[model samples]
Target: MPARRKDPAIPAGLKIMAPEPAVRLAKEAEIGGLGLDWSEQPEMLDDVGLAEWERLAGVFAHDATRFREGERAAITAYCSWWSAFATAAADVRDRGPVVEGRSDMDRGRLVKNPATVAMREASQQLRYWARELGLTTDARVRIGLADQGDDKNDDDNPFA
Candidate 1:
């Protein structure tokens, strides 16, 4: 089990109004609202991404059936990294695929920022944890997730 958040932003009415699963996450993650809304408002976590983000968050937040210890910390790290992802993505989104910045060695010279690299790295972190926690759609399917069982063949999937 993980320690409670030091400063939980507990939301109003979620305890009574949210759906059963979301209510569980709110309590387990000790988050405000249904643990469904984003703090940074990243486009990556909006639209279809919102549903995916919420689902992934539920796995990290729920308490009754944790895969192992330190889950809450992992959840917090995941969200923090996602915020980083969003911020970096925002730069890329606004400036197009490439942007110009001054080189570290020489401020006078122009250099390409290529925010996509940072965006990709942040996205990779999110994806890595999702796979680690079995939160991805493909991961869920491979582990017989609909029936809700651990991936018994995890050892057999040599590539994994």
Candidate 2:
């Protein structure tokens, strides 16, 4: 059996009040409330938080008419939740290596998926924000994408 999912460490409140699931929780926490006291609970938000959901709703609101056209992916709304569990590290500089590693991992797994690229982009933006805010060090930003299992090579593809 798969390992039990870990419970989100975020506190009971401070989450967005919306029920929508598309908003990226980390983005919300980072940019939603200014100077929000998130020193506790690992400083991460859940994908289900109301505030994040509202943001997701707003993104869709840009083209509300497209829903009937089947323009959105079933998982698009939930993908942003992946970042909600991100911890507000005690020191941004200290976590730089980890963030870099996570970025590379996300990029490696982002093959053939536009959403993955968006997520990777969002992660990079967040890192820059952290640096600009003086919340962490900039030294750990990774410059190269690591080869993930999906790397396509002429030798492996029968069609190639």
Estimate TM-scores for all models: 0.46, 0.22
lDDT (0 to 1) per candidate = 0.60, 0.39
**Local lDDT at 135 for model 2:** 28
Q: What is every candidate's alpha-carbon RMSD to the true fold?
A: 15.1, 23.5
Model 1, span 11-98: residue lDDT tens: 6445545668756665766543323332333343444455545655465454344443335445545656676787788887787774
lDDT of 2 by residue, 1-160 (tens): 9998645886655555775544544344444332222112222345443354355455445543322222122223232333532322222334332332335567543234334444466567655543432223332234232233535667977886
On lDDT, the leading prediction is 1
Candidate 1 CA-lDDT value: 0.60
Backbone clashes under 3 angstroms, per model: 0, 7
